[model samples]
Target: MPSSVPSFAELLNQCERSAIHLELRDCYASTERFEAWKRGERIDWEDRESWWHPYDQLIAETVARGVSVRRARIVSEPVSEYIRWEHYVTHANVTAGEEVRWLPRRQATSISLPGNDFWLFDGALLRVHHFSGDGVVVEDEITADPETVKLCSAAFEAVWERALPHHLYTI
Candidate 1:
């Protein structure tokens, strides 16, 4: 029989040692976890306010890791409904990196559901797959496949090429 599938955390651990790619859609768990890991904090799903803190950490960690993080959203709507004026304020307060790429709806190629918005991290790849009316599911894994990595890399680049620069107002 084929070897059993690896667990999500196990895959992440493996990815840390090799090349891995991930894609997240319509949700923020991957980002949240990335942040939590960076800050050495625990992720508390029960606390709503606690979530964004980790997301902020994730962004900083991604920058520090020197790995490329790419995001794409439907131009017709904001990338995240969770992102509000306060979110921007929080981002400004915590992050000091240059403007990262933001892909608008017009630029993004629409894919079907069961398809995810992606969060590609170099060290540990994390993907959050969202289903309408349902919730988000996560897949963390490692792979040595260059093609898979290239596909995600190209998709991010395509979106980035068409994305507008993000401008945030500092508090």
Candidate 2:
């Protein structure tokens, strides 16, 4: 693993074929947006401009270049409030051309997953996210180790295969 980890934007820009993300945690650090959503705030689904984020634009652009951007979440069933809110906002990801899915944690009991969440870029470089128990990101470890990359790539594909597409998954 390299001490100097590149920003996600840099990795995405360098990606050629595919970028896959595996989110293992049921909850992440709460943000103002999440808090608002908890307070009953919702996106006017019809108003795309209102909720479109710069991150969504980056995903859109990456897809435009023919890269496959996919995200899979392994969440506990009877999901937490954060997952519910994440599910609602995922429309932004789909609208930006990224494929997204969800896998109940119970269904993934037999699979071999990394200890932390990760983004595998082009089946080569891996950015492993180390998060605090409170869900704040503590470090981003970048590695191009063949074994690590292979493990993450395989783990992502395994989860993706069994996961339900975002549209079909219910809270």
Worst 10 residues of 1 by lDDT: 14-23
As a TM-score, model 2 comes out at: 0.97
| RMSD, every candidate, angstroms | 8.7, 1.9
Lowest lDDT sum, 10 consecutive residues, model 2, at 1-10
Global lDDT scores for all candidate models? 0.43, 0.95
The candidate that achieves the highest lDDT relative to the unseen native structure: 2
lDDT of 1 by residue, 29-54 (tens): 33553454546664454464655554
In model 1, which runs have C-alpha deviations exceeding 4 angstroms? Answer: 1-52, 65-70, 77-99, 109-114, 123-132, 138-144, 168-171
Off by over 4 Å in 2: 1-3
Error of 2 at 109 (Å): 0.8
Q: Residue by residue across 1-171, what tens digits does model 2's lDDT show? A: 555777899999999999999999999999999999999989998998899998999999999999999999999989999999999999999999999999999999999999999999999999999999999999999999999998999999999999999999999
lDDT of 2: 0.95
